[model samples]
Target: MTIQVGDRIPSATLNVLKDGVQAITTDEIFNGRKVVLFSVPGAFTPTCSAKHLPGYVEKFGAFKDKGVEVACMAVNDAFVMKAWAKDQNVPEDLMMLADGNANLARALGLEMDATAFGMGLRSKRFALYADDGVVKALQVEAPGEFKVSSADAMLESLA
Candidate 1:
């Protein structure tokens, strides 16, 4: 089922590129922290590169100031996510999570089939706010739309 407000984030392992590709579990990320996790269909895709990720990169500190650690997730591999982070000049603390197998998306019931577009299974564009593992808010965008899940919109929801 789709994760909802007050739901505990499901357990999953995702990759991040640090000294090398490192496996991070969901418990390590959401436990004892306020996190804002935003997902993209793929890294380096037009809208994701130009807008969605950039919005988070720009406002990362604002979210930090409010005590929320921000993370960006994509269904692409860790290498691609790392390259995109470097290309975007993403802040070190703004985690780049690679859900290469789309496991987490599938677990959350947010996986999208993009095989018709030549892209395989991917994540739907969405964002969620969680405090110490419990979801506080979630904003999932309508396909082909970008209104609700933007960093600005998520921040506003926190306010």
Candidate 2:
């Protein structure tokens, strides 16, 4: 079953780029915080690059003002994620997390197979409001749709 609101996020390691090195784990991120975590199918893809991530990047401050830490995760490696963040002109507040091995995605039951597109296993597009490791709100897109989970939409939920 897919994860739902009130589910506790599974303990899994995530690849994070910091100071030319790799830092891993979910605890480092959600131990005791209110987080707005969003996942994309793949980095540099059409909707993900043009709309998904940019939406979060744009509203990052609003999230912070609402006491939410913003994070963007993809199945790509840290190098790719960091480069994509730079390409997207990501600011410092929005964290780019890498689920390179898809372990986290699989744990959350949100893994997607895009092998037909030359991309391997990846994450589906979704967003969640997590407080100290437990989910408070969850929104998963109905495959190829982007209606309710945009950054603005998530912010509206907090209001």
Candidate 3:
């Protein structure tokens, strides 16, 4: 089952492109912090590029004002994620988490099969408000749908 509110996020390793490839765990990112973690099916897909990811980037300051750490994750490798972030001009305040190999996605039960699309394993579009390792709110989009997981939607929910 997908993670629910009050559920503790699974400890999974995620690769990040710092100065170089660095491995970080879910606990290091989320434990003892209020985090707004959003996931996309793919990094540069149209919707994700145009709206999903941009929404969060645009609202980075707002989330920080609320004392929330903002992170975006995809099943792509670290290089792609770093490239995408640079291309999109992702601010330093926002984190680009690479869930290479779908470890984090599968651990969270949010992996989607997109082999037909030639993308193999990917993460479903979803967003969660996690506080100190415990989820406070979670939104998972239906396959091919985008309604409740946008940054504005998540912001309103935080209020």
Q: Pick the candidate with the highest TM-score.
A: 1
Best-performing candidate as measured by lDDT:
1
How many residue pairs collide in each prediction?
A: 0, 0, 0
Ranking under TM-score, best-scoring first? 1, 3, 2
Task: Sort the predicted structures by lDDT, highest score first.
Answer: 1, 3, 2
Off by over 4 Å in 3: none
| 40-147: candidate 2 lDDT, tens digit per residue | 998999999999998998898899898899999999899999999999999977889999989989999999998998888989999999999899988899988996
Please give, for residues 1-159, the per-residue lDDT of candidate 1 as tens digits: 899999999999999988899999999999999999999998999999999999999999899999999999999999999999999999999999999999999999999999999999999999999999999999999998898999999999999
Looking at model 1, the pairs that clash are: none
TM-score of each: 0.99, 0.96, 0.98
Candidate 2 — which pairs collide?
A: none
RMSD of every candidate to native, in Å, equals 0.6, 1.0, 0.7
- Across 11-103, the per-residue lDDT of candidate 3 in tens digits comes to 999999988999999999998999999999999999999999989988988999999999999999999999999989899878899998999
Candidate 1: list runs displaced more than 4 Å. none
For model 2, what is the alpha-carbon lDDT of residue 119?
A: 86
Task: Tell me the whole-model lDDT of each prediction, alpha carbons only.
Answer: 0.95, 0.90, 0.93
